[model samples]
Target chain A: MPIGDAPPLVRPIVGRANRPAITSHRGRARWERLAPYLLIAPAVLVIVLFRLWPLLLGVNFSFTGDGDRNGTPVGLDNYTDLWNDPVFRIALRNVGLLVLLLPVAVAIPGLLATFIFLRVPGNRLYRTVYFFPAVLSPVIIGSIFNLLLAYDGPLNELLQTAGLGSVDWLGDPKVAIFTVVGVHIWATFGMALVVFLAGFATLDTTLLDAARSDGASLPQVIWHVIVPGLSRTIQFVFVTTMIGMLTSMFGLLYVMTSGGPGGSTYLPEYYIWIQQGQMNRPALASAASTVLFLVMLVVGLAQIGLLRKAGRED
Target chain B: MRELRVTKWVAAVPMMAIALATIYPLIFTLNVALKTRHEYILDRFSLTESLRWDNLGAAWTSGGISRYFINSLIVVGFAVALLLLFGSMAGFALSHLRFRGSRTLFLACLAALFIPFQVIMVPLARTMADTGLMDTYPGLILAYVAQFLPFTIYLMASYYNGIPAEIVDAARIDGNGPFGVYRRIMVPLGAPALLSVGILDALFCWNDVLIALLMMPSAQHRTLMIGVTSLRGQYSSDIPTFSAGVLIAAVPVLAVYLFFQRQIAEAVTAGSMKG
Candidate 1:
């Protein structure tokens, strides 16, 4: 039988229960059949109990009340509170900002990966230096930037020496989110660049050579040849980068801004942390978590759909 | 040809500039770490006249970083070990064994990869608390395992799939059972994948703040990353000491990144390319 057509749980149990007859060849054959399930049992158990089950439980919990009305079902109230809360609104808006900034984030790595793919001078050193920060914790990165972006810090000092005005990098509300996002891009673009380089590794160099032989300009070659060739990688980076923006910048916001400068740098993950951990509003945080989950789900589905359509065109 | 050459040089300029930008912060932090608080206040831009070993010494001995560093080490070590063992077991079984619901289980694992920890963290925390595992080392280790196991299994499965089944058949023909093949043959064959995945998982567990924060709530249980965060508030006015603390938290990661940089990139791209 094909893997997809495997029978349900009954056969596995039947095989296991026959172990008392182990002296028989039939029992030994049954053991052979049960080995794969036995091997996978622990991983399956952990993933189901912790990862998958909690997802369902969290969505169920989101509709309940927090605090004095704890564990009591209050349908849609938590979500309404989330929608009305201004901090959560800013978090949602910042998610939108991340969506808008996604292209720039992806493009930076894509372009650099292309250059490195072409083996630019000092490409190896550039890759090493760039990827170093990606391995560092965001807390360390944030703390380091905390010094560099301080009002009288080295960056501002350099700006002052350049005869330019020193801007408040983390203190100004309008600028704090962008500043954090910029640091995030700095820290993470190397990851995407590595992914892009991996994609470039699979590209047929003959296509690039063909385009070059046709005297195509750099931009034309990129647009007509590389873009089409690496569409999947581009889409992969887009989704993963957006997911990183949404879910992984918590440490940066936590240490660098603490969702401050008037609560301006709150992403969904940080908002969830604050509501659940600091604010003691787990239900409300669950609602926000649900929204974040939905956003990711929609993004994932749309990309898969787009990938399918793109594949069809091919 | 001339145009391409010109473009390459143009690209080289920014690439070099970016490389400087990338390396500058750590250099700046190192310089700051080497300064005394007095010197840092006097001239943050100036190079330290002497390496102030006292700052690093104070940070390590008294800043609670040593405790947090041990906590992270224990949790990440056990977590990566568990992930590799469980991941390789499932990968071997799934790739080579014929079993019921195997495809469904594999798909389920794949589906679980999409559920990032943030989505389930609230309930997962409650689950941890309910089981009396919260705020404990094993609790945190289990959490890390749950978080990274799917990715680990996926990569291991993909890697093992490349091994010809005839070798497995030969091993079986040599009177080895499934567990025997796994122990005597598969584990050896899966070493490279296990190394890549283990390094990535170690980095994830070590560098994580949010999961560590949620799972280990007490001050004594903080991971190194958490220790670094606490350093910010504790040493806010003491820039040199804070820089030293940051360096202490960062140095091991720096060491790991330097040593295993290739494996890390390989693991990261392994997931992407397979997808």
Candidate 2:
């Protein structure tokens, strides 16, 4: 009967089990009070010490100097250094580029989910193939794309056969960021599509039926029905897809570009890697980490604000 | 819904094309993996004329992916086990057993979710090194648990939220303590979420390149993804062997996806719905 399983609404059983002895009652009281904390203690400790503590430590550590400057305080030196670096500037620029492209990333999945939900021909097969890429490591995706997008690779060979000039997808500074961004989208859009499908599962089919009865076309049905119905899901996808872009592209950049021929592929995450690991500038890396956090927070909060407005209007 | 069928067929055409595009890259890579270097150099797009299985063996051994593969297995295995254990415990407590600072703790966990690993990589690396846990398997495993445990707990808590309270109270009436209820009831009831979250955690730990790279700096400690990254430098001229290495790393994920696609999708959306 699984009688022992219960939900959170159960009133706390206070003194239900009669205990005659004072000491035993006190012990039971103490155990009841501490039980939840005991269960949560390991998780809370790990989160506090590792995740939250590191955030505070990273920000605090950023003000300190690295190497020769060592343990001594050097407030704003790392910040100024980060501000002056050309590669850092390019990293920030690439972040701006990602922000501009967020909608296309969101839309691709949104539209695909619509097709999948509507049960397009071979939809079952389509969903499997589409979602397969999302499961793969970016390292694998990047390697495959590296092969496919290599200068004399298959993509170029196909282009040449079509009488097009061979384009250097990875070697060109201007094109490399877009290429990486494209591959990232290719790999992740399926995840967002699945989320959108889940949202569709909760959708009011009556609304769609009414829209279709009114002779609504496909675009109108999607706009008037699905978008408004799945506002929360849409917003969720927006924030997450953006976050995924900001943080998860390191492997792609590492394998595909390594911050590139002209440093065109330097996202802040990649910048942090190079500074902390390769450049031996942990302090500077901390400063960059703080900046990345601030950037993420701003972008995240701003996205929520915008999405809420858009959601409300819809 | 009946009227939508014709339009679905229309939409299906392009969706199928996109699906082919999605599947083509890996298929393309698999084909490349089977080709000899000369065959690949002759034509990258053409199908291989012969089944050359030796490339996989060569990449497995001399290319050094096997060492990294074993390393990944050990680290991911332990990290995921710890994650599920800790995650489900905290999740049960947080969802069902309200106490002092419970809300605050949950909020703190969610706040940690906002923190990208890159944001903490520098200070974390220092913390790890300071404790002398750096460049080792336990160090890497612990780092992964720290990185992913929040998402795991969040998912499990939400999953546990769906179970009815009567079950727990009933268990209590049967003389079960909190831990007893967790083990006898919550664990069994939460199997679906456990499987879903477990697979997701496995994928995250398996696919991670950044945390592993930062935590384990030495070549011998490299995970499979790192092995793939390193292959580019070593096998630049041997495209087929490099592709073979990539196939070796991808096959496990491919198998997981094939078997548990629905669970993966459910886990992803469980996260979205909560957020």
Best by DockQ: 1
Model 1: runs farther than 4 Å from truth?
Answer: A4-24, A304-314
- Writing each residue's lDDT as its tens digit, candidate 2 over A1-314 gives 12232333333345444664566646665666677788888888888888899999999999999999987899899999999999999999999999999999999989988888877878788878889999999999999999999898889989999999999999998888999999999999999989998899999998888888888888999988999899989889888998999999999999899998889899999999998998899999999999998998899899999988887775
DockQ of each: 0.61, 0.60
lDDT of the candidates, in the order given: 0.89, 0.90
lDDT of 1 by residue, A48-101 (tens): 999999999999999999999999999999999998999989998998898889
Q: In candidate 2, which residue pairs get closer than 3 Å at backbone N, Cα or C atoms, i.e. clash?
A: A4-B167, A4-B168, A4-B171, A5-B167, A5-B168, A6-B165, A6-B168, A7-B164, A7-B165
Each model's TM-score for chain A is 0.91, 0.93
True interface contacts retained by model 2: 0.76
Candidate 1: residue A167 Cα off by (Å): 0.9
Model 1 per-residue lDDT tens digits across residues B1-275: 67887899899999999999999999999999999889998898789988998899888878888898889899999999999999999998888887768888999999999898889999999999999999999999999999999999999999999999788878776667788889998899889888989999999999998999999889998998998888877887899988999999889889988999999999999989876
